[model samples]
Target chain A: MVNEQGYNVALVGATGAVGHKMLETLERKKFPIKQLTLLSSSRSAGKKINFKGEEYTVQEATPESFEGIQIALFSAGGSVSKSLAHEAVARGAVVIDNTSAFRMDENVPLVVPEVNEEDIAKHNGIIANPNCSTIQMVAALKPIQAKFGMSRVIVSTYQAVSGAGNLAIDELKDQSQAFLNGEDMEANLLPVSGDKKHYPIAFNALPQIDVFQENGYTYEEMKMINETKKIMHAPGLPVAATCVRLPFFTSHAESVYVEVADENVTVKDIQSALVNADGIILEDDPSTQTYPTPLSASGKSEVFVGRVRKDLDNAKGFHLWVVSDNLLKGAAWNSVQIAESLIKNNWL
Target chain B: MVNEQGYNVALVGATGAVGHKMLETLERKKFPIKQLTLLSSSRSAGKKINFKGEEYTVQEATPESFEGIQIALFSAGGSVSKSLAHEAVARGAVVIDNTSAFRMDENVPLVVPEVNEEDIAKHNGIIANPNCSTIQMVAALKPIQAKFGMSRVIVSTYQAVSGAGNLAIDELKDQSQAFLNGEDMEANLLPVSGDKKHYPIAFNALPQIDVFQENGYTYEEMKMINETKKIMHAPGLPVAATCVRLPFFTSHAESVYVEVADENVTVKDIQSALVNADGIILEDDPSTQTYPTPLSASGKSEVFVGRVRKDLDNAKGFHLWVVSDNLLKGAAWNSVQIAESLIKNNWL
Candidate 1:
């Protein structure tokens, strides 16, 4: 199917929430693609998708589906990526997986293009994207880390329901309407679909994101803690996270506290570092009541930073409010940027 | 109207949210009241409030409103408290003010009955109820600090829209309905009612809580920091807070990180401390997806503690999720409890 004008690219999980954004991002960024194949699970197969005024049919993915594919983006689920990512890689395709499958495999490079693009070059045919919560925190922290060394990080997140998937989005919509109507709000999926219990996410906050790990931290919380150290290349960094799912449908907002290694770093110093960073927008001005909210950052690609202030007691400690569209910069756009980086740097 | 059986009580801001809750709590707790005087601003003066099967008319509060008032509970705006609290005290009334007007005044005691009922005895006529967000956090941290001695505290709050007042609750409800109807969300009051800019709180998170202070922190955040030190009697304690307003209408949830001074402390130790502490509930069972959420804790009087986990790197540090009904424990119930202590201990 290759016309030799550009590289052959295949998108796995084309029916997913992140997948929908990935396709849109690839088209908007004008990614080099000569032949585009859409793959999904058997349940979602035979679907039609319109891209750039062209209609494409989705097919159930098999190992043979990746033949001659130069680039593959996987985001269906962990099991799907676990079973099919190697198949795609074995077929001469570089995989940028958005699941937690091979992120800590030691052979894979976990990357946030803005934070750790150089690690993409060392991928063994498959690169891993960090969690949505981790991606935004690291994107905002990288600039500060580059200018002033960071000693510790503690973050608490207000995440969106879209990160749970499309069905979860539907659940929020239904529940919000029910709650507004003074009716009983029914919940089928939230907090986690596979978890033992489901809680309502409309006009409420759920403290759990993923399944609880053995060490008392949720898998989502551990992913944020471990992924930040991996992407920043500081294996000994002390990071703590408490991930809570709010009722929002788009962006994830985080309250981050960082202790810098350098002495006498003021709030101005932190603002100067983030304002000039590659993919960050600083919107902090308390006098004008200016700051980024989930609604304001719903569709933006760049990470938004605001509410910067110094810890009243600790001279080196600073607090920041970081917000970004979880589907865009957190997953889809970050994955597409990795594909672009591979082609730009001749890493593939 | 004073009788020999019970103390005469005066309720300020009788038509407001906290004032409504105050009436409900006083009735539920069956506080001894021979006569009740309802007072409010001029706009709400004629509003009729039903209390204990009797209808009471709210009167415009003046300097003479507290004449023979044994206990005057003020929940109106800070300006009303600043102008009338001292006048109420001058008339031989014990004022329990639920505003920031006298909280930082050295002569007044900021009281959370669960943590520091003894501090109520030190009040110079006016006892200040700590901020709602602060009351819940300190109630959770007090037991832990008493058991292991805390050194530093970092908190990120998921506060409800009702914390801003009744109009904010209406704004959230109206905007949420509009958002669900595919209409634009109108914003008239949120983050701070008197602040220059108003952001929509429907399915959104606003980082600013109270008006911003000269120190680049919100007045709400500063209240948390300074009041925590004062209530805990630890002047050198390092406390940092980021207060964010979410769309929830009732309860406030907090993700707290505390560094205990003890050499070694486990999650079990922390839970045991909270389970035995007064006015605290331990609802942490990760295996069953148990945790305290805003919706679940909306009407509860106790502080709900869950998701207790030790830090991965520091053995002395721990993280906890705390939730409580802002109107009850954070405002009305707490203020009423202080009044009860004043009567029970004969401190008035």
Candidate 2:
């Protein structure tokens, strides 16, 4: 149904944080489209968004809204995607879901183009975008694993507040202002929006990124662990994660430790492997004091890898620092990239 | 020389961050002080400080300053401690140095009061206080290690800018205001004050805590690794650390992973050991969404431990979240605690 004039595209939840980024990304990449439909929940249905110098009003999404749509990009909440994504698929539109609704579904393919582009073809109707933290780590580690082979991985993340959405971002801003003015600040959303207790993230670090699971691991940490396994196709790989939320507004940085399979693998080997990999930029030079900080990698689509070093004790052990804009390569950009992959492969 | 009445005590770098904390700790602990002599470099000299409703003027420290001083606390720069610690020891004072200069000296005891207070008697003249990050971790891990016998330890730190100095604290505040006001943030003293190419730490996380060493690890990381070995008296224990500076004003939090010697060790056993250990607080209960955060643990002397769990893959492997006031248990309080132990045990 897609022609050279472009596909009939629909953007669902086009008013949320990641959804706004999706619109910008789609416009910046100049993805072809004969028609662009903006859809949202009833609350944001009347909102107007500008795309490619054209004004579009966001309409309330319904099953019939996808009558002639060829591609639908979803960034709404999980329930929205859970209730509406299959309806879009039933109408012959391919859905690229940005929520956790279908990410782990056996029939749905969890895709990170850099790590598993081939998985896109096997999707039944809905293609799942991996978690933001998981996408960045797997993208940075894919090249290393391909070159040296990884057996074990341990990661500790310094995540930003934007991953929790726009409300969390406003909380950080208002809290920071109040903190600076020596006034009391309120915390209604943060660490986990749905969790019982809320904590201030103005000048502090919260170890919990999401609601706790029965296993004592936060949902965010468990997502990083499980999604990494699925994307890497390494179910038996030993992976552990400690996810923490910092005060930054954008980008997530991680301290990753990996044990490679080969004994002769060096940091230089890993660096060289990642330097030329697609969607990864290497910024490591200890002598020059060059490594990626969250601010330095805040507004780009590439996953930055740095601080590569060999462990002193374990011969096969290596350490890496990975950084990327949580909203870009982690969410919006990755989703757009999957859409591009779908078009290039004619999967839609 | 040591009587029930009091003893002559000298406080070096009285105007600096840790030195100020040392003064406060000594005052709070009601340490017996017959005459208090405040010493600093020529730059900070002549400043007046109040102790017990009396004012004491800081004087430029010289070799003669320690002639009758019973206990000398040094927290100036490393070179200052290197230049004057032994001079104080040579005269009649027992030096409790808070700089890295003497921490690694074979004759010096790097003491964490809760971990190894008995080592105080082994000090020739100088007892070195461990680094702020190292002190908190070792204090929390000592009880667990004592009970289970640790085999390997790995730690990643969420350290505060206050650990850098008072100037870094100002920098964080100013830069934060500038960032919120949409102005440029200047970074002159961060990551490492002496290191070149400063980066903004107002709302960011810097992975390089101190200057990079020859092995690519920062001096801060190396200090944590080396100091932990010396304090734990386990030279053969495999330990690794990644030190990062966050945007907090006090307290340092660590994500520690340890492999114990005993296979039957459980999280409950680890919690029991830390709950009863002196200077350790256990705040772990995932069911209740309770865990120790940096802000919650700020200004506290005890090392707060939480998020205790056994690793999914390794039965003997356990994870702990450790937090404490970097200026208190990490430096000033630990130094004063050592002095207290010395008095109680009649070692001085």
* Candidate No. with top lDDT: 1
Instruction: Name model 1 segments beyond 4 Å from true.
Output: A1-4, B1-4
List DockQ, one per candidate, in order: 0.90, 0.76
Tens-place lDDT digits, model 2, residues A1-348 = 346888899999899999989988988898898899999999999999999889999999999999999999999889999999999999999999999999889899999999999999999989999999999999998998998898988888899999999999899989999989999879899888888889999989898988888888888888998899999999988899999999999999998889999989987899999998999999999998899999999889999998888887888988888999999999999999999999888887
- Per-residue accuracy of model 1 over A1-348 as CA lDDT, tens digit each: 323488899999999999999999999998889999999999999999998899999999999999999999999999999999999999999999999999988999999988889999898999999899999999999999999999999999999999999999999999989998899999888889987789899999999999999999999999999999999999999999999999989999999999998778989999999999988999999999989999999888999999999998888899999999999999999999999899888898
* DockQ score for model 1: 0.90
Q: Report how far residue B3 has shifted in candidate 1, in Å.
A: 8.8
What tens-digit string does per-residue lDDT give for candidate 1 at B1-348? 323499999999999999999999999999999899999999999989999999999999999999999999999989999999999999999999999999989999999988889999898899999999999999999999998999999999999988888999899999999988899988988877777888899999999999999999999999999999988988899999999999889999999999999857888999999999999999999989999999999988999999999999888889999999999999999999998899888898
lDDT of 2 by residue, B1-348 (tens): 358888899999999999999989998999998899999999989999998899889999999999999899999989999999889999979999999998898989999988899899998989999999999999888898899899988888899989989999899999999999999999998878888789999889898987899888889989999999999999988888888899988899999989998989988999999999999989998877789998999888899999898888788888888999999998999999999988888889
Clashes of each: 0, 0
- Cα lDDT for residue A201, model 2? 95
**Interface RMSD for candidates 1 onward, in order:** 0.5, 0.9
